[model samples]
Target: MKWGRKSMLVAAAAAMLATAACGSKAGDSGAPANEAGGAAKPGNAILATLGEGNDNLQGKKIALIMQFNEGAFSAQYVAGVKEQVESLGGTLQVQAAGNNLADMASKLDAAVNGGFDGILTDHGTAEALEAGVKKAVDKGIPVVAFDANLNVPGVTVLQQSDEEMSKQLLEKMKEDIGGKGNIVKVWVAGFAPMERRQISYKAFMDANPDIKEIAHFGTADKPALDTQNQMEAILKQYPNEGDISAVWASWDEFAKGATRAIQQAGRNEIKVYGIDMSDEDLQLIQDENSPWVASIAVDPKDIGRVQTRYLYQKLHGDQTDEKVVLEAVMVTRDALPKDKKINTTELGEYIEGWGKSEQGIADWMGRSDK
Candidate 1:
């Protein structure tokens, strides 16, 4: 169960074949314009173009079971899936397990027995949902997972390259802090992606012995509030400008909290780095006094659309990769709007790949071949 960097590389190289193209995303008019009179390309819009054969999806019943529905990321992901499913004339049954494995198990069972054509498990784990996934697969229901490593056969696992992402963020932190400093780590175990990222994190920490980890903590549920409280306590405990040189958060929510705490403590010297990007996360980075430096960006909406499209392909007898590992990029304060407020949709414009990865996948599937 130990996911090594070598395995991560192989999976990533294979998955890269699905997202190599770069161009205007699906719904964009591809016209040239500028921000001069506000007629520029709108970044905050649904980016995936629906496939032509939605008629095939008409009347098909699909189910999306989520492990938790706590943030804008989850909302956007479901919105992307709903857009695709409804456009294709299908009805999607949405259910949230609210971080309860038993609830996830029950939902999976219900979806299978209720005769759903396809099932999508979002942000779950194999230890919790494997049996349900296996039963659904055995019943011939096409199942695709987004960020869930459910080790069940015949299930397509879709996720971003977490290990590589962690490495990128940590490397950035190393550069920013001059390779050696007292750092705090925010993490929570039992999640698959977090576990993989932990491997990458440990490797980085071990490789750099001078970087002392002063404390470790994380938050869930009300992540923004809880993380802020935890970090504020950490700051109070350390209580010095350079005592805490940097903080490496496993995810953006934790980073946001840490950054807020640092800002409040007036410890601008402490830089915060993390994985995952959101509009709010970028807003923090855009703040002139913010301690957040950078993070790995993965558009949840794009991920939802891509996984759904891949599921569509699987249903239509198209052979797809067993695992679809997404490509992600680093987004810094430099890439965000300087003086104005921006949502995730608008924020995505600054990321290199943005909506293009799913478009590439759809293009490769010949969804636009007509």
Candidate 2:
């Protein structure tokens, strides 16, 4: 919960299993390069790589139940999943659980009993949805979790490499600030990814004594606005340049808020380092006078595509790994084009290892018409 103060040592140690993965995300290369995180579809071209389509996925029903649909990340992720399902001729129903834990649990239970052929969930805790997920598995329904912590048998869990992302971001933050200074942290605990990320933050803090944390505040509610309000208050408290060296935002919403606050306060002297990505986040980072420098994240759309593909694989009676982890890329302003705006689909050209993944590509799940 309180990840910043005294209880960070154990979390630091747990976060030490650093990821050693990098390459092109092959699965997302199926479609034509699309711009922006929104309105892009990773087409059927990837079907060329798979062996055959069972044709069983067509006409099947899918239920995508989410805990929240906030920001460009969630929207683009949902868009990817929807388009993937449609390309396979499957019907998808998305349920938004908002901010209520009970609502999240009930959505899973409803998906199970609602006669859907397969289910995909985004961002719910094992405590709230484990029983329902277990029940779904027992009922012979295929379930895939994106950024959720449930580890039920017969279910697949997919997540970005959080440890590596954090490691990448913080190392850069340290370098940007000359390896020592005060910073403010924005993050929340409870969600799986956030918890994983905190591990690296704690470890980084422990390793670098010169890097001092001056303030910390975060929330899942109206994350960007809340962070802006809090960060604005912190700016006023410190007011002078160099009083805060940088802000470490574990999520993009926090980064957006912090960057806005610092810019409004005319504090470009401070840098903002964060995790997660989106088109809007790109624009912010690319701003002429923006303080948001870098972000480490996987393409959110690819996350959805991978999750849905795994679900379809299960439907085709193919075996898939219980855990699917995608590689991450550090998108820096220097790496992006000065003249053109790009989306996750086109990021590979500018940022290395952007959309590369091999998780759900199956020999039995490509298009038969081809």
Candidate 3:
């Protein structure tokens, strides 16, 4: 949890494994032109080649349960999963919960009873689904949690490392704001990863007294709305409080909402920061007129592919550790080379290459063990 040397070493190994496992099959052509940890231009050829060698997944049934089918961001993740599942020769049955815990529990139970070989779940309100997950494990089914958090005992892997991601976001925010500003924090309830992000942000705040959290939007089902309302309320109460300099939401939607409220209030001084590398957020950062500053890019497509690969390996008897945490890279428009703009079109291609490359797949597989 401290992210000490041991943690870094482990994370580094996982990253290596993820990179290596990207392209691992014959005639698989989506391998990125650049090496892992390197940069490459994005293109359609890359998307076409996504998940080439993942055919090893043939003849398997992978049940996917998403928190909600809404949002382009969520849709992309599901698309990524579908692509990987098909490439690996696995069949996918997707069910959406519409952000309802009861629906999620019912669907999860059906997946288990229907004899799904493996299960993929996006982190939601785990408390509501904890019992359901336990029941699945009781039936010898392995579950992979992505983007969200659930403390289910038999979870083959906990997909993302939120603490590290949060730290990266905070560091980027400080750099974007020139290292000193008052910040507001917001998060969603039962979304474990966001909770972890809040913890990391709190740590950063503790170390930097100058950066105080004036208000917090506690976790809720629709955290973006709650966060927006909180920001609006704060701006009204502190009308002239020029000290409020930044708004940090745990997710991009919340950040977007906060930005909207700030703009409506005619406060252009407050910068906005958050996670989830959503296209809208990226465009906002790219816009000269926008107050959006930076974000920690979490490639859901890549996360889906990696999660699938890990599950496949585990099913095939790979000796993986109990947890796999992927580190997210900080992304700012300023960080992009002037010659190389952020290529939204190339994201799928890059991820595809990462998923198909042999070394990339191996590297990602290794991360599970570490």
Q: Arrange candidates, best lDDT first.
A: 2, 1, 3
| lDDT of the candidates, in the order given | 0.67, 0.74, 0.58
Question: Best by lDDT, which number?
Answer: 2
For model 3, give the 10-residue run with minimal summed lDDT.
19-28
Q: Give the best candidate by TM-score.
A: 2
Clashing pairs in 1: none
What's model 3's lDDT at 320? 51
Whole-model alpha-carbon lDDT for candidate 1: 0.67
Give Cα distance to truth, residue 336, candidate 3, Å: 3.9
Candidate 1 local lDDT, 217-271, one digit each (tens)? 6545455566677788888999877788898988776777788888888889889
Q: Give per-model TM-scores.
A: 0.82, 0.87, 0.74
